[model samples]
Every structure is written in C-alpha cells, then in structure tokens.
Target: MKRNSLLLLWLFIFWSVLIWSAIDPKDYPTWFLEVFPALIGFVVLAATYRRFSLTPLVYLLILIHAIILMVGGHYTYAEVPLGEWMKEWFGLARNDYDKIGHFAQGFVPFMIAREIVIRNKVFKSRGWMHFFLLCFVMALSAFYELIEWWVALLSKEAAAAFLGTQGYVWDTQSDMFFALIGGLCAWVLLTKLHDRQLREL
Candidate 1:
C-alpha cells in the first residue's frame, strides 16, 4: 500500500479502537491509566511525522502496540475476554494479557529506539547498539513498574486492574523479564528487515 494510505488506515484503526475502548470501560481511572501512553504516543507521532518520517514497519508496530493498550484499557488486562479464555484453557493462575502488553512495551519501544539510533548514526558498533537497546527497554519496563507501584499506593481500587499482578509473587520481575525477552526477540528477528527499511529511507 502507499505510505499515506497505510498511515491513514492506521490512524483510522487507532481512533476507532480508542472510541470503542472509551465506551463504558471497566472504570474511568483504570482505563485512563492504561491508555494514557497510547494517547501520548499519538501526539508524539503527529508532532514528529513530517520532521521524522519513520519506516512503515515501525509505524505499523506502533499502531499494533496502541491497539493492544486500548483493548487492555477497555477491559482491564485481568478481565479481557481473550485472556480469560486462555486462562481457562491453559488452567493458568491469571490472565496473561498484561504480560503481552509488557512484552510489547519492550518489543515496540526497542524498535523505535533502534531506528532512532541507527538513522541518527548514534552508535558505531552494532553490538553496542543492540546492547543499549535492550538496556533502554528494560529500564523503560522497570520505570513502568514503579509507576504502577506509585499508582497502587495512591489508589487501591485502581491499582489491581492497573497492576494486573493476579497474585503472582514476582509479577514485576516477570514483567521486566518478558520485556527483556521481547527486546531480544525483536533484535534477533527484525534487525535485518529494519536495516533494509532504514536503507530505503
């Protein structure tokens, strides 16, 4: 598809999901907390669109990440129907949707960071660039966990849905672990393709 058309479609899907997510979500506060990042991302993308046109791959990934966040916001990660089904089918302790979100937290951001570093010629060594990307994403995940902690301390009711710990003792650790895995996976699977796209730019 043409770049403009594809971007238009992405924007349409984003707004459509945002609207659906906002309609009688599980709770206003939890929904806001969950979707706030996506909203902020939209603004950032718009502001940077002309000055910094990203590769189509990155844009598509961002849209996917946004959709994930909006869906989680709509149902709260613990109560999402797909996660609930998986929970029952797998006989797991709790829904794993939140884990997927956290993974994407690492997955998408690392790509964004990777693209920025590569396009800007920020790093000379490929090894160092990849290492820095993983570290950056892990730090991002840890900061998000701290944000959850702060939110929980401030509002008990909103925290459970926002945290989505589901009684796991090592939820925070596992969350960052998943993010680390995501960063590694993205690098392993997409680095060549990302490089191609950057070359095209």
Candidate 2:
C-alpha cells in the first residue's frame, strides 16, 4: 500500500476508536478531554504525512502512547482497571497507570522531537540537542500540569478525574519527574535506533 494510504488507514482506525470511546457511557468525561491532544496530533500528522516518512518504531511508539491515553481516559487514571489490579496484586496503595501515561506523554514526544531535529538538521550541536530535548520535555510536562490546574479551577469535579492523583500529595511533581525519566529513556533507546531508521529513509 502507499504510505499515505497506510497513514490514512491508521488515522481512520484511531478516530473510529476515539469516536466510539467518546460515546461510551462507561468512560469518564475527562477521557475525551485527555484525548484531545492526540486527536489534534493526528490531524497535524495527517496534514504532513506526504512530506514525511516516519520510522515504524516511531509509529508504534505513537500508537502505544495513544492507547495509554485512551485507557487513562476510560478509567480516570487513578482508578485504571489494570493498574488497580496490579496494585492489589503487588499490595500498593493506589493505581499507578496514570504515571505510565504521563511518562509516555514525554517519552513519545522526545522521539518526535528527535525525528524533527535530525530530519531538519535544526542545530549543529549534538550535546545541545540532547539538552534542549530534556528541557523541552520538562517544559511540556509543566505546561500540561498548568492545563490540569486550569481545568481544576474551572471544573473541580471533572478536573479531579482528569488529575487522577489517587491520593498522592506530590502527584504533579511526580508526573513531571516521570516525564523527565521517560525523556531520558527515549534519548537512550531511540537515538541509535532513530539514526538507523534515518539511514534507511
């Protein structure tokens, strides 16, 4: 199949699932709101699909990240079924799947930035690239936290569901920290892989 066609197919599947999830009564209101970014990202990517050829690994990562968001939306993060089950099995205090989602929010975006930087040759300084990538992920996380705060101010109940703190006093701090960790991990894991993918492209 043509690359553009494949991209369209993937997008169609994503949106179909999203539309279904949006109307599903079992999902929390925050679920749809949380998915807003991914939906927007899809539209942006689709618009540029013909001009870009992303690595299969990057596509897989994006899909995984989207699924994480969808799952969090469905269960309101703190009460995610899988996380709650894991918590019970491991005897933890609360569900931690939301952490995973937030981490990927940074992790996946790290590769997206890396792809853009390498593909565009945005900067000549390799060390600075990594530094800027870390800073970028942190800034993104902080901005998201602010968004959460704003949502809380506007709609306390819905925002509580969106925050998905699960009783952690340092939820916001930990979210950013995990995102930082994920950014580092993405750099470590995808740097060489992305280089290889770039060569193939």
Candidate 3:
C-alpha cells in the first residue's frame, strides 16, 4: 500500500509539473519540442508496466528526466533561470541548462537501454555489450542534433529557443560530446547499482 501511494505521488508530481509547463511557456512550439519526449516516455512506461516493469532506479531517473524536460519546456533551455543563476555565479559564457538536458538525454536513455539489453541477454560478451551501448547512445545523441536542425528549418520563429544554441557555432557538437560523456560516465558509475537492481527485479 505504501509503495502504491508513493507511485501515485510520483505520478501526481509529474502531471503537476507537466501542467504547469504547458500553461504558458516561452513558446508553444518550443514547449512541445522539449516536452514531447516526456509524453512519449509516459506512454511507453504505461504500456510496459505490467509485462515489463523497469527497476525503481530506472523509473526514478525517468521522472527526473521528465521534470528536466518540462522545466526546459517552460523557460526554453537558453533562458532557464537556474542556468542563468549558475552562469552568473560561476561567470560562465552562457546558460548551460541545455547541456544538463543533453546529459540526461544520454544518461537516462543509457540506463534504460542497458537494462533492456541485460534483462534480455542480448549480448554474450560484456565487451560487445558496452560497445553496442556506446554506439546506441552516440547515435541517439547525434540524431537529436539532427532533429534540432530539422526543426529549426521548419519553424524559424521557434528555432532559436528550441535549438537553444545561444549563438555558439559549436553548440550542437558540444551537446553530442556532453551526451557521449554522460553515457560513458553512466556506465562507469551505475553498472554496479544497476546490476544489483536487476537482480532484485
């Protein structure tokens, strides 16, 4: 019962943040671009809950990612207040909240992919599994950059906010690099805990 209540609370918080994000954003299109993945994730989780429920750590990470998405949607990544605060405090070149989003993009998805791969016994060799994971995460990261490019071309009005490039010529490249780093770090930092959780699951 307590576990069920906690799950409900988790859902309530997600919906609350999503609603707040949707009420009024920096721009409607940019909001959709950012929040769409969270919406898809919610659907996928619901669909798989009974037959293939993920580990609690994965679920928690997904929620955190969704919250990051919604927050970025509400303010647009370049103008996020938290990122702005950090930028000023640290004397940085630009708001880097988008980097957080990119990092989570790699980190959370790598966990999900690793869980799915391990649970299914997809690779006989650990080395091969790691290789596949790196490829998958990097591909995902690069594809997302392509998405930003395509979207920028489609909607000039929302391009700047949605892309969150902030006049940096290498923003897209850096985003992918951060994602690669995130993926590598996640594998190093999370493999042990994730393996324990997999045993429990």
> What lDDT would each prediction earn against the true structure?
0.95, 0.83, 0.92
Q: Which stretches of candidate 2 lie over 4 Å from their true place?
A: 1-9, 23-28
RMSD of each: 0.8, 2.0, 1.2
Which prediction has the highest lDDT against the true structure?
1
Which is the better candidate, 1 or 3, if ranked by TM-score? 1
lDDT of candidate 1 at residue 56, scale 0 to 100: 92
- What TM-scores do the predictions have? 0.98, 0.90, 0.96
Which pairs of residues have clashing backbones in candidate 3?
Answer: none
Alpha-carbon lDDT of model 3? 0.92
- Show where candidate 3 strays beyond 4 Å: none
* lDDT, ranked from best to worst: 1, 3, 2
lDDT of 2 at 61: 86
Per-residue lDDT of model 1, residues 1-201, tens digit only: 888899889989999999999999999999999999999999999999999999999998999999999999999999999898998999988899998998999999999999999889999999999999999999999999999999999999899999999899999999999999999999999999999999998
Q: Is candidate 2 or candidate 3 better by lDDT?
A: 3
Q: Give lDDT tens digits, candidate 2, residues 88-121.
A: 8999888989889878988999998888898899
Give the per-residue lDDT of model 3 (tens digit) for 84-185. 999999999999999999998889889999999999999999889988888898899999999888998999999999998888999988998888888898
Could you tell me the C-alpha RMSD of candidate 2 in Å?
2.0
* Superposed Cα deviation of residue 187, candidate 3 (Å): 0.9
Residue 183, model 3: Cα distance from true site in angstroms? 0.7
Clashes of each: 0, 0, 0
